[model samples]
Target: MIDFLNSIDTQLFLFLNGLHNAFFDPIMYWLSDKWIWVPMYVFMAYLIVKHYKMKGILIILTVGVVIALCDQTASHLIKHAVMRLRPSHEPSLVGLIHLSKAGPGGMYGFVSSHAANAFGLATFLYFVLDGRLRILKYWLFIWAILVSYSRIYNGVHYPGDVIVAAIIGTLIGWGMSKLFLYIENRRLKNK
Candidate 1:
């Protein structure tokens, strides 16, 4: 069963890789890094503040910090400890797709920071702001899924890495939301 599941994952990864190469080659090369993501985060923070006021601003900031910590901890420490090579970096998987420049980075691929960060923020915001921003919750999840797929498409992370990162990110997001909600409710009661 595990082998079968792995095979499906490999096929899914390859399909996404092919799609990216076919349709988003320029975007992948140009807009797939911190430059794009940081501005996005800034915009998201702005929107959160605009909509939710001061409380929303504080929650967004907290979630941003948590996402950054989770992304870096998984990408740097756990990934290095695991030391799983990317498909492009592996001899066996070469020629399956066009490989991107390595860029300045470490040689680890157990979990994709891109996937974790995007999905973590998405999930966190989804739960926290769902009541007020019902439509946005769906868009946020779609955005997270696409970001996760982009990692595989860019040939920097395997299917396993993306999956694990997503799961870990979701869990962290959900946990943080619950924690914050509990604290906020307690404060409300006190008030």
Candidate 2:
């Protein structure tokens, strides 16, 4: 079963990676780049402050915490444990993958930290901002999915790696959101 799934993953990776062109390459790279999202982060902070006032600062801080957890767990724990070779580094995929990296990626690519962090922030924001901004719930997931797709297009990770990271990241984000809410409710009760 694992072999079959891996086979499918490679085939899908090739198909998706094959579709990239010069025009879209830079865009995907930018989407996957962490620094490029600074504006988005600032905007998110503004949104939280606008809606929740002083308490909104807490949500912004929690987002950072959530992303840190997702990134560290995915990169340090899961990827090292799995040790799956990146498509760009896989011997079998030589001459087939479109290597788009500025530098060689890590040896293993089991769980993509990029996907984990992006989805983690998205899911956490969706939960914390629940009902306040209905549109953002869908937007956040779509943004996360786009960023995950960029990992496959960048040739550093397979679709399976991104998907697995997204699931784990979402779970982590959900757990954090619940924990935050529970503490908040308890504090309000005490007050």
Candidate 3:
């Protein structure tokens, strides 16, 4: 079953990586670049501050926790445990894979930190905002999807890697959001 799933993952990776073109190569590279999203990060900070005011600090802290958890889990724990080679680094996929200038990232690519972090933030915000700013919350998901897809497009991650990372991220996000809410409610009650 594992071999069968790996075969499908390879095929899917090839299909998605093959879709790259001159027009989208740079765009995908940009999307996959972590530093390129600083403006969006700043905007998120502004929104949290604007909406939650003093409590925005707490929200921001929770966001940090979510990202830290996602990054460590995806990059350190799972990747090391699985030790699966990225498509770019896979000998069988040497000629078949398409990589941006960024090249193959770290050796293992079982779960993508980029996808985890993006989806983690998106899921957390979606729940935190709840009914208040419906459009913004929905847009957060679109952003997460695009970021996750970009990992596959850039050839560093298989679709399965991104999918699993997204699931893990969503779960972590949900858990953190629940914890944040519980703490917030308790603080209010005490006040």
Candidate 4:
């Protein structure tokens, strides 16, 4: 079962990577600049604040911090413990596509942080926000999916890496939302 899943994941990764390179890669590369992330972070923060007020803002921020921490920790563990080489660095996978230049330390690639972080934020926001922001939710999902695809398109991570990271991120988001709601209700009862 695991091998079957892995095979499917690899094929999906290749398909998505090709699609990303053909369409979304250039746009994401332009937008993946640090400054762009900063503004996006601020905008997401603003949305949380506007929708949920102070308590919601705090909860969202806490979730964001936790997600970031989880992303980093998981990436570190997989990179160090697994010692998996990136697809781009693998001679077998060479000529698959144009790969982005490697960063310092020859970082190991397994779980993708981009996938984790983007899906983490998207899932958390979708869970926390009430009412029918259906369009926004769709867009968020799209964004998360696209970001995950970027990792493979850049040849920095395997399909398994992004898939597991996405699952982890989604679970974290959902769990945090429930926790936040419970805390809020308890506080209200105490008031």
Question: How many clashes in each candidate?
Answer: 0, 0, 0, 0
Q: Rank the candidates by TM-score, best first.
A: 3, 2, 1, 4
Clashing pairs in 2: none
RMSD of 4: 3.0
Per-residue CA lDDT of model 3 for 1-191, tens digit only, reads: 99999999999989999999999999999988889989988987888788889988788888999999999999999999999999888998888888999988988999999999988988888888757668778988898899889899999999999999999999999999898889889999999
Candidate 4 clashing pairs?
none
Q: Candidate 4: what lDDT? A: 0.69
- Candidate 2 lDDT tens digits, 90-166: 99899998867544488999999999998898888888886877777778898899999999998999999999999
lDDT of 4 by residue, 31-111 (tens): 334455677667766776776688766866676675776577567766678776666676665666555543211557667
Worst 10 residues of 1 by lDDT: 98-107
RMSD of 2: 1.2
TM-score of 3: 0.97
Give stretches of model 2 more than 4 Å off.
101-103
lDDT of 1 at 88: 65
Which candidate number has the best TM-score? 3
lDDT for residue 90 in candidate 2, whole number 0-100: 95
Candidates ranked, most accurate by lDDT first: 3, 2, 1, 4
- Cα deviation in Å at residue 58, candidate 3? 0.9
Q: Which model, 1 or 3, shows the larger TM-score?
A: 3
Worst 10 residues of 4 by lDDT: 97-106
lDDT, each prediction: 0.75, 0.89, 0.90, 0.69
Off by more than 4 A, model 3: none
